[model samples]
Target: MAAGGPPPVLGVDACRGGWVGVLLALGRPSVALFAPRAAELVARAGAAAAALTVVGIDIPVGLSAGGPRQADLLAARELGARRSSVFRTPSRAALEAPTHAEANARSRAAGGEGVSAQAYALRTKVLEVDAWLRDRTAGPRVVEVHPELSYAVLTGAPARHPKRTWAGSEERRAALRAAGIELAGDLGEAGERAGPDDVLDAAVAAWSAARVATGAARSLPDPPEELEDGVLAAIWA
Candidate 1:
């Protein structure tokens, strides 16, 4: 058989009890939830590996040892009041802690501003993706994405309400439509399948994956940083 064409783009968002993934391929969108692990999630998205191009996720990748990552800083500056959406990623050392208290302590010891309870809650998920990327032989095409950042770009203004609210979800849907992304299926239905916020974030991630594949997306740091352990760190939208 002839070599396959580029892989389709995928967008993933962490959900209530698992992860929500959106696969946009051949102009079709499919959603799935992966609770077992991040590796399984990526594998599902890469079922057609030869055709996989970009995988966008709403989680922190490539961490900073001290202070905030260049990408987080940039995202905060652009997001204004909504900047809290961009949580500071903990250093690898800090992530070794087994508890929120320990992680916060470790984060401070590592020279960061200390991990928040919100950031601590995501430790397992972040570590899952971090470990998955570390073990990938071909390196991962994964990019960090913030749905709010994508929405801001789409609407030319910061989001006014939380994504969990009906108003926020509608705003997101409007932004998606404004960006020209086709939502063939009902967004509310998609949210029912996962969560309103999760589905919406995944949709934005998928849209960003398309942008990355087309070279139209801009990353926070322009050129991303590659950690010595093979993690590529950058937030794109």
Candidate 2:
């Protein structure tokens, strides 16, 4: 832990400038910050990094070589109408491709469906996180997370509105409050750069990270698949 308190947990989400991270301790949000990279965001926790319990991030951690990940399929199934939020992760080969056309071709050749434009757009962030995890030293247990899945588990149903909408943002905030984390007052520059949805997503990801620390979270695939580099391919909530 950090000094005398329990270990801190983190939730991170990709934002316009870079990444938004929420650090929680004793089940409450302690700080929120924005960083240009994942490592810098984690370093925001300082001493806590050495004893950080879990880190939940809204990105695909492990890429499948053969086809679409079962974890993504299961998360979509769980979301029902909100299933579209869970994009199919491109195969490792597709992720390494230089262009969308190349990615789609690689995906198809690997027995996976064509990559969606949205999913393709995230290739950089996905690969960044993947590489980070591979080179990570012993600090926190990082896991793949989906904000929609976290919100669904918290509210006991899929979110009724899109996160970018006012109603949807309100719904997500309510879910966070209901789970005992409140987001109020000023959040400094972090709040300025990240959108409301990005903040909310990071908050909920922290909630899931707490659950993971306490052994209460559930993975989309109970037995998470392992990538060759040893990253677990599963979405936890």
TM-score of each: 0.87, 0.93
lDDT of 1 by residue, 1-237 (tens): 012322477789987667777766753444444545666767877774446788899999886665667888899889999998888777877776888788888777767777888888888888888878767887347888999998887678899998889999888988876655545455443355577678778878888887888788899887877655565678898
Candidate 1 wrong stretches, greater than 4 Å:
1-7, 29-35, 48-50, 182-193, 226-230
Alpha carbon lDDT at 52, candidate 1: 76
Stretches of candidate 2 off by over 4 Å are 1-6, 27-29, 47-50
Local accuracy of candidate 2 as per-residue lDDT tens digits, 1-237: 123334688999999979998888763446888899998898776454456778999999888886678899999999999999999988889989999999999988877899999999988898998888878776688988999999999989999999999999888888887777777668887899999999999999988998898888889798898766566689999
Clashing pairs in 2: none
RMSD of each: 4.0, 2.6
Query: Where's the lowest-lDDT run of ten residues in candidate 1?
Result: 1-10
- TM-score, candidate number 1: 0.87
User: Using alpha carbons, what is the TM-score of model 2?
Assistant: 0.93
